[model samples]
Target: MTDLDDPGLLDDVHPRAVLAELFARQVRADPRAVAVQHAGKELTRGELDDWSDTIAADLQAVGVRPGHLVGLAVERGPVAIVAVLGLIKAGAGYLALDPDLPRRRQRALISAAAPVALIVQDHLDRLPTHHLPTVWADEAGLGDAARPEAPPPDDDGSRVFHVVSTSGTTGSPRAVRIGYGAVLNRLRWMWTDHPFPTGAAVLIHKSYGLVASPWEMLGGLLQGIRSVSLRRDELLDPVLLTDAVLDRRVTHLYLTPQLITGLLDELDGRTSAAPDIALVTSGADTLPVDLVHRFRRRLPGATLLNLYGATETASNTAAFDTARLAEDAVTVPVGRPVAGAELSVRDRHLRPVPIGVRGEVCVAGPPLALGYLGDAPDSAERFVRMPDGSVLHRTGDVGRWSADRQLEIIGRLDNQVKVRGYRVVLEDVEAAIAEAPNVTAAGVHAAPPAGDTVLIACVAGTKDLEIAALRAYLRERLPDYMVPSRVHRVAALPANSAGKLDRTRLADLAADAERPVAARTLTPRGPLQSALATCWEELLGRGPAEAEEDFLDAGGHSVLVVRLIGRLEKATGVDLPLREVLENPTFGGIATALQRRAAR
Candidate 1:
């Protein structure tokens, strides 16, 4: 066996070398550059350093310390940035929670993370059930919570900050421990290969915008570069995003494919403030060539790069730079591995496959993960492996090296499906669905059919495309069994924080649509509350859901509303909108609304 600790190999590059030291070096070298921007406001590097120091001091006040995980659950703004820097300055990892996630989902994440404290925006107050100490992300008092005068460290004390969270899949999120090694190496790679001009203003607009913007910021922050943080919610208006970028003199705009698509749709003739950003990067999901072409045509000044990577894999594993997107290689190639990263195809045995052979792509590099939280070092072998001398990471992604050594991602092994005597790749099926005219994103889910598997496809289509035509088009690419039994043509697919189609929530939506379940009027139960309980029983079906449960969260929607209101009107003899039923959904709220209508 080859020496597992071979010194010559790239895998030997220490993961610890990736983080803290670089951040400290950067800070010391330059402390006066603007570090963050929120809603057009700028915070300089020195200000950010001082601010982060204060925030870190505040975190210590709240009992958070080095090596602890701080839950960063807040909207994308100055507060989120400060909280992140604070946690990292304290030498802790942060679990990012977006404000847009459904409360139940956020609660599940909090449970999984089990953070020492959750730093949140003030508007979000319903998170107590998860029952963790809450640190407000933007506490004005934290400004004075500075670190005390200290003697110099014996060593060059510096730390690379890492943002950690669970995979977008596997339901509830948890803390995925990230050492600076992975984070810094990835940034260093970006700087070496995709260098941007110093002092360029970069606008970060992606969902995990903080994490995604690392490439631009890590490079920019040290060189007096400006980073702009536009609120994702505010940018729901595409014009606002464009305006924000142009107004802020944004020179590098990193956004997800969805946001780019939204901006394209909203923009007709285009006004001023078309961001002067010279380089725009987007990824985390497939960037359709059509969209890529559209972006290229629209943004003539920028170099559009399709970046593909995951949270654990140091944010970006590969990138496909597009000079002209439709140049035969329209599909984004995760590009050549950055410096300190190694890429090779491997078989199931973890042996390296021959060049150009398709197998699971294994990455052996300096930037490998430190492993998940609470997981054993042995557990690292599951993804970070020592199978063939050098430690290699087995990315579930199926890919092969080209003649040029550029990787071509086939799909994920987890996405592979074996139908009745036939193997099917869901990515292949998704590609077929996207073949339908006007379909941008396609999600396919399977349910068990009698003696066979059933396929259901949810596609995002424009109004111009008919479902029948889409169905007909899909029939050409997919076989009969593979053809979807139900094809939903919605405005767009529901994407989670990462801008990739959320398969779990899509599965839930599919189940909800299929089952057609309705909500029942549930009241707080007590012997003394008999009259309210009786009203609930008579007005709707079953027991009361908790106060936190919304009509929609309880799996009730408009179709279910039709049945519910029919039943409610018959029992309570009061008509209410499907909206009213959902708004004041509880038995008490519904009853009170009915009583008001009666009095009127």
Candidate 2:
């Protein structure tokens, strides 16, 4: 308790300090500096400030005031940055509506946020229709009028700065409210510890819908460093992303482990020198030691850090530098708490556990977010008030402190499932599978409780690794109840937009794997049927059980469905609409529809 209150634990930034004020100082210091770069255009600090001030005036005219929440549905560009700065200048927090997500999901988030107004990028159709007053980012008349002279709204650090939607893989999404002070603390700590050099640039490639986007886009800007924005299509192509990093002189890059692996693979194939990045940070998922070693080999000069936090913690609380890690280290510790933050491993009773004992990882500090926006019960449960008047966030993650004070994360408490009356940790099973020869990655899921429940696993490995051999390897290392009953081999595991493992998609694949083998041996009837079936098998990593076997039942999700449709159209030389594939979700149904369309 005393450690929690220690003055040294606080960040150097004043509690009353806000990002808007800090950014203004940077603008005044160097107005001619490039503030943001996108596509082939650049915006200087003075120009950006003027543009945002115009937007702020427009928002204020519409009755937007301090503490109001505004919806920003803009794509990644200079205009998007202007919208964010304008929202803060107007003293209104922003809720970014990702244009790539489904319209329904965007609508759901807007409903939860209940924002007073919406700022949109022209021609963006991914958002649902709303009655809120709209301001177009790409409007021809924008910034045409003279800039208003009204002073910027005052912020004491208690006002909400933004709202981030939780992943909601297991349930409905919840909006997490973050304050100006919380994020300012996070950015200040990064600036102090990993100082950005002059002429340095940060690649703002992550989706604005994610919690990490704010820091990725603004952390460098507040320090007068340039931010380079990448379009979604460019981000998906490894070569394009690598080229952008090199061409833009990006000094700081942050990505999840999955995306990092892709970038490393691309670098391995290149004859050119690796990009001269100063710092590379990995977060949003576990950083595998193998990946860390690959980064070390690929970018020897750059510092590699593993950051650990959640949407509720302003994106980062602890960081570990893998530069000096030993060769034989099995796991990477998340390292000590960042400035202005404190970490504790506590038991179910909210009592702190001794070092080296696993418990729920709780974070307490100024970086902690306000809480869930609309869900009071959930906010109360996850954000607990300690007897000392300090608020701590229960991360639901299992972790322990090492003898040297490093934090080692175990697995999630919710991932614990009962199998054959014995409790088992899914991550432990995945780790055992990953240890198998040539197995690159693994994901495990537990089937719904029935008369006899079972465990399923999906592994991505070399062709030499057979399912029989993998099962035997698991049996040797894990208990009988812990051994997965069914295993599926794939080219690679799927990842979400944020570059983290898509657990829900993995569970869908596992469910498909759980079906009996005899039922999955259907024969294609014609060339059209065979081509469609081939595409389905390739995408799902398994064949259909019957002609009527549903595509979704065969582990196909929304993201996979799009890929499937694209492949089908290419292979068959026929135009297939997305709705046609979704409406006819069965192998027989889609094949018949495609044949008819081809004949017509």
Candidate 3:
């Protein structure tokens, strides 16, 4: 038999055959155990099982069937978990839809998935403008129907379990289809190797739509560990989240590098021991050596693990536990493959490169997702066969195998990028920006000259666009990180001899054009304006400021606004509210607000 048919190539996941089956087993073993806690609501395993059973029956009544896809527009809470589990029991795959998304984008995603029905919470204040039939969380008479049982595992493991959307190069949603076997293999591996002490609570920090969400939500459930779902507001404030972790006695936590940095900053060199934390997982960007050292020094009792994976791989394939890592290491290695994963560094022709030589990182084994949702070109290009008849995925990331068999990722081979742990396609950002009103063309680039990498957009529009307005427009359509940090308006973008956009020239322009607009001629007239201008200049990275120059247009964001307000309050001894500062973002306007507050 070929490798595809060879039973030895794949492991048989028994007892806990699939996710729904495993969850059912957990419920049977400890029905009274707390399975999830979110926003003061504690759900026992028995409660969750019964709740999900009712929801599953309701879903089945609404025509949800095996292998069918359903839309989930609920936020992070107990209901979200109930919906996911209930859908699994109904033998349906779910596509998580972000409720905060704009109506247009939501409609587009619904059209793309064509889910049989949308699952939403009854308490949600807003609903997407779509024609799909919806199943409300608070539907009546669901308990009258019998609970559905978990379906048997598909022998070939080709059953789609769920779908997560990643940014596409074509400016549309790229839905990743993960199969039951692929998810089961990863979950089983985590349950076997990454064991948490009994009663440990995994923190669900990311949104339900991100790939990390599954690992946080389902990974804990697989091993009978309780999960704590953070509130949406708590996620935006690191200080609040840190306090929640301490208050909730959270043992397991997951974060991106950016959030880790923010949390570290909040801690501010407090090396006091926090022994309650057993493990801390981080990914989305390369974890710096200094940060790892800092984490070990402070939280010595916990293990800090660096995970490396993609959405197509069903989550992480490799992990490096920094607690045992050497301090003098130059570059933090991505570590060896995790359970059931195989890694190889190969050249363009797919030939294995020698150890210590940098090449494309390829992953083989059960952790691989079935493929992209539909027959997209990238689907075939990513999953290809080897001469040995083994299916390996081309990760497009460059890496090398060390002498000790560790893998160190160097960089990507394409323009696709990771901004603060979120994958983004530069072309996608440009496409979205170009489609904005009054914009003719746009070029976007990730410029990281001195480690402070930020996305810069160079646009050629028919009419001059307000920086704040443009940013607000883009934020509604794209994720925050995909929105350009700086927007440089130009008459026209430069083109090469082939009449195609010359990205190299655009990069040079962005590098040189750090100051987007000329300084306004109106200089600070009084002491208050001068002091406010100085604060603005220092925070915005500008040479000098003008009274008429808008603070937002000068690259000042909400965070910077907070900092500026704090400094002004301390320096001027005036109590100023954030709304006052934001209402008047110009130098003169802020000065006036400060003067009025001082007079009061």
Candidate 4:
């Protein structure tokens, strides 16, 4: 076994560094620089330091100590950033919770984290059922007596920095404990390789509770770069995102491939290129070749990078520059390992596979997370010690090493599914659905045959169970994507002799149970409506559509909406606003609107 302290190998920098310590260094160096901006609120480094210190003091008073996990429930804003930094300053790890997530899910995640205290932006009256002490963001008279301190007294890198919840093997969410040192290492890597200019403004539009949020919000603090938080609604609008980037002169921006595609489509009809951006990093899913090319064309001045990694590994293990892709390259390579990281493709036997052979993708690095918080068995199984004593994290993704040594991700080795860029385990959705009233057993899967990835859920329940009610139940407890496009009442879900779920049979049953569209009672009144209805029918793969049937309920999602709108624009030579398309989604409403537009 290779010795860890071998003199020949260079020692890692920031070895004993804590995440808060790194950010504190920047605050001391430039106190007057803007540290964060959100809505109309801006906080300078000195101000942010003071604010975080006060919150930390409040946390300290509430028994929040070193290594404690604090649940943070707040909207995406300057206050949210303050809460996160304050948790770090208090030497406590934070579990970020999206205020908008279903109360049940929030409660479940919070219960799993078992935080000593829960912090929120304003009122905590609406918070889910939890027994933890609640700390309000506006703790006015509590800690204002003392002057703002710098960082905390503690500088232990071994303490857990944050607990990130990801799709678990079971139905519940698995919390991953990441050390302060691991988070610091990732920031150090970004600063060294993809250096952002000191004090440059960076747009942080990613949602809370996601792994990427920390990288965007805190990573910038290490280099004195301003972290600008965009509200959830602002992040959803393409035009707003473009404007935000340009208005802030954002030097660094991160997006998923889906967002990138939406932004590209928004920019397509524009007369000029978007304002110059320094770096645009994309991840969370495979970057499509077409989207890469479009991004290059739309933002020629920006360096577009495809980052590949997982929640267990903090951030990126490998990065691919779209500019390096060969003209004939069919798949965009994930590129070589990042600094202080190693990539190995190993077969089922755990032996290294040939360079060109497909196998499980494994990563080893200093930035590797501590492990799954409460899942020791899973942690041991996924993180294995090699014969040489080095640890390797088996990322269940299947990929192969290219001729040029780049990693190409091909597929998943398990039941994990990604919908519109969010990673989800199928069992998690099934578990959520099974909790519904009267649902005896539930099976959920992402069906690709619907022309798009539409979630189809089948449940064995009483004959009187309503599909719409079941959908509403899921919607209240899960994200929209996790909700089924259609809920089919199955007599009983088939299982194999070994007692495992027979997914093949479940899928077949789901396919056979889909509802066919009924014949239209009302004929098209005009060519505009007639043509649009025909297009909708073809896109929905249904017969004549009902006038009031919800478009999304009819198996359409945001992705399909884009394609449908694009087709409508091409067919009718009329530029339509996305708001109109969404608002008048039904055939009768859309048809009438189109006819009116033609009249104009």
Candidate 5:
């Protein structure tokens, strides 16, 4: 065992062993600094560290021992991160669970995790009592736990600490164990390189609030800075996200394109002063070049950075500084690996491919996680041993190195997509679509649903895809991406009873872009509102759709609809359209302003 107190230990090189040791020192230095803020609440470093200690002590009291399996429901905010740190402090590795999970599905995960003690908020009595022990993480419970005495620490980075659930492409979620050695390796790399400068704090976008950023959670822990944790769903809601940023005066933050789109659209109404934020990071999904340009145009002072990583590799293994975005967007590489991590392009044979050659992404570092748990034996084969006998988790994502030795994400080698930054499987979208009302059967494709970041589906009639409505149905069971972006209703889908789509035919449908079916939603009209809405709905190919509360915010592509006048004439029976919809927009004063054209 290693004691955390050895001087200059972390300065030279440290491992997961060093992470646990830094706990007290970090607290001592920044005890009063704000650690997290959510729903009008704030937690400080001393408070979180103290709470983590208690959580660790409490779990130990409940028969949780070193290496015991503990199931942690991954939720947004301070409590979630504290719970995970508590597991490590208790000498147990934790399994992450998403709170929004359906009961039966959650039950299956609980069964698989077989956690000795589960940490969860009792807010929803939704999770049924399990055969295994349970600990409700309410206010009273937290207050009663004891503070953890720091463990005798070491610099050994190889200790196991967590089991992350990753559903690659589609299947049951596999738990990937991330060891201490790996965690330390990753945190060291991040802190040593792209730190937010000492004393600078960062806000978690809350989309990934469940998992701490190497910079936000651990990096803050190790480096004596603050990671302002915002509530997850609340952040998704624009007003709340903006308020959180301003109120907290966040200096650094990370978000995806979907989020940036919303934030940028909503920023004007929220506050005149942009929060103190300087660095805005994005990744884990495609960063649209247009959106990147929009941010620079709007917030000329803000720095946008793109970070890339996966569960297999610790969060933020590589980052592309957004400053590079002004020059060239698409060609921007994922950039140099953090401090000690190594990223490479490997060929099918698992051999390192030459720079600029496309290959499988392989990452090796102290922060890399162990292989997936309880998986098919063959899955283990993907773990390749390097010449020095080190292990690298194979990220099936395809990428290439630039002439400058930077890694660039090409796309997924599998059939998965991240919508709004959440990884979604196309098959899952199909299954959910199959469950839609009046939907006898369906097939989903990554086909740009009417050019929006949505799944495309062909339903059973001339019935156009009621996207907003269908989304409501899918939201009941599946995550957002599983809902098809557009549902096409054809009397008969070209499929065999053995049931497989004639993808060739579907591609043809997408090509003609004939999805004129409108989504079902509260209608907007007047000449300008109605005409603009009609063109948008048609060009995008589906909607009985209610226009967005904010037009520009809903994702309008000016280039995609150059024929705005013709399309509007075809749908709304009126037109005075200019170069684009932006020319005139609103129900109060547009064409139909005189006669109230009812919502269809």
Candidate 6:
């Protein structure tokens, strides 16, 4: 068994120091170090400190006080970073609101968080118009005025540092209140266990609304390391992101599995020199073993670490370094509990299960977040008091200790769905599909209720995959009931703003594919129609597709549409508008639009 009771490791974490204090210490240590870089601009530690201090003073002057919640709806950049620091220095916790999310959802989150004031980027029109007192972050501290002399508010590490919302995949998003003590412990453990070089840079490209974003944005700054911030559009473009990492000399990266997979694909077969990345941490979703192998092969010099935890646990409780994984390793273990954290697998009754027995993964210790904000019942239910006086947060994730004592996550307890009459674990099916030839990633979801709920599988691969062969491959391993009844090919699985797999969107797509649509017997007439039909058939894995068939009904999603558009543009040399193609999704509509443009 692996022993995690290390007194030295526990003693390293400063119990009283909060994030604000730690950042202040870094500023004092090296004021000239570059703290944040975004788009061609950079902010030195001293500049960031003064700007945030001035903003903090401005916030304090407008009735913002310690323990107050302030809403931050700013685009990703230096301004957002400064706003976060400013709020922390003012002794107020921030509620991050992503500018890309729907205005209704943003308003809903703001209402739920009930922040006293809002900090927004004035140029972003997507931000909702809130009635709260507003502070324009972009213009707050841009002037060369004198820095404030007032010191930051005192913090004992018990105050709420931030309030972030859950992914809301299963239901409405829950606001989680994370205290400074929890975040401080997590940061301390990360710095101690995986310390980066002095001038190393980290990327902060994740949506600010996510619970995981703060670690990316603040982790490097607190240690006096440069953090490169990318806009959402830049983050979506793999080539641009790779260029940024290589150009900015990013040595460390914390990304979701989905995002990392895309980056690895972009980096594959490149002749350019690989970036000097020292560490790449994967979290926010399950890290696939295939991805681990790919990372080992593609960038053998860098170490890949799989971190496991949730929003309630301040992002990660345990981490596994995939440095010396065996060639035949099937699943990646989430590793032992980090310093200042205790992890145990428990049964339904919350009793500790025997080693190697699959059960719910429960976390205890200082790294655990306070609880869900504004929901006392949920807080009490998830954050249960143990008989030993330690508060244990039940992670709904199902996992077990391996023979070597590392935690191996099986799947979510809630992911067990009823297919026909038999119960099926989606992750199990996804694993089998992912092992198939050419397949890189896979997602399995059960279709919504009808007469009978059927299982659907979505697979993304380097090459085209045959559904019949995939089903046959699954039949050899999975049981009859476990085999997915329907399969869809996608360029990549969809991810939410948080970078986690959007399972809700996947299920909706699967359900839409299952819905029968009337097929019109329309054949290709012109060159445009012929090209459109060919591309559609190739993308959807159905040849000789009718022009009148709805693209979405034939298992075509936005990702696939983008690929289809690329193929059509290459084939005909006519510039096609993405919005036009999406608005008129049918092959006939697209072909007509293309013909009209060509005629002009």
TM-score of each: 0.63, 0.73, 0.86, 0.85, 0.76, 0.74
Q: Write down the worst ten-residue block by lDDT for model 4.
A: 1-10
**In candidate 5, what are the lDDT values of residues 1-600, reduced to their tens digit?**
122235566643434445665766667767887766656777777777777888888787788876677776645567776876787677777766667665544565666667777777777546656766665555565545577654444434445576665544333445566666666666665554555665577675442223334456566655666677775444555555677677767767777776677678778655576667677888767777777787887778878877788776757678876667545555556777764678888888888888878899888865576666666343566576777989877877799988777788898665667664666666656665676666776666566542346556666632555645665565555533444545555566676456777766766664444434334464664454555655555655443244333222232322232344445545655533332244433322333432333332
Root-mean-square deviation of every model: 14.9, 12.0, 5.2, 5.4, 8.0, 11.3
Clash counts per candidate, in order, are: 13, 0, 0, 0, 25, 0
Give lDDT tens digits, candidate 6, residues 51-76.
88777877787788877888888877
lDDT of each: 0.59, 0.75, 0.76, 0.74, 0.62, 0.73
> Which of the predicted structures, 3 or 4, would earn the higher TM-score when compared with the native?
3
Per residue, candidate 3 scores C-alpha lDDT tens digits across 35-86 of: 8888787878888878788888778888887788898888777777788888
lDDT of candidate 3 vs native? 0.76
| 125-146 per-residue lDDT for model 4 (tens digits) | 5678768787777636333534
Worst ten-residue run, lDDT, model 6?
Answer: 1-10
Worst lDDT 10-window in candidate 2: 1-10
Cα RMSD for predicted model 1: 14.9
Candidate 2 at 59: error in angstroms?
Answer: 0.5
Is 1 or 5 the stronger prediction by lDDT?
A: 5
lDDT of residue 481 for candidate 5: 40
Model 3 earns a TM-score of 0.86
Kindly report which residue stretches of model 4 are placed more than 4 angstroms away from their true locations once superposed: 1-18, 139-156, 449-452, 491-499, 515-600
How close to the true structure is residue 428 of candidate 3, measured as C-alpha lDDT?
85
**Top TM-score: which candidate number?**
3
The alpha-carbon lDDT assigned to residue 509 of candidate 3 equals 79
Model 6's TM-score against the true structure: 0.74
Runs in model 6 lying further than 4 Å from the true structure: 1-18, 25-32, 125-129, 146-153, 167-171, 415-600
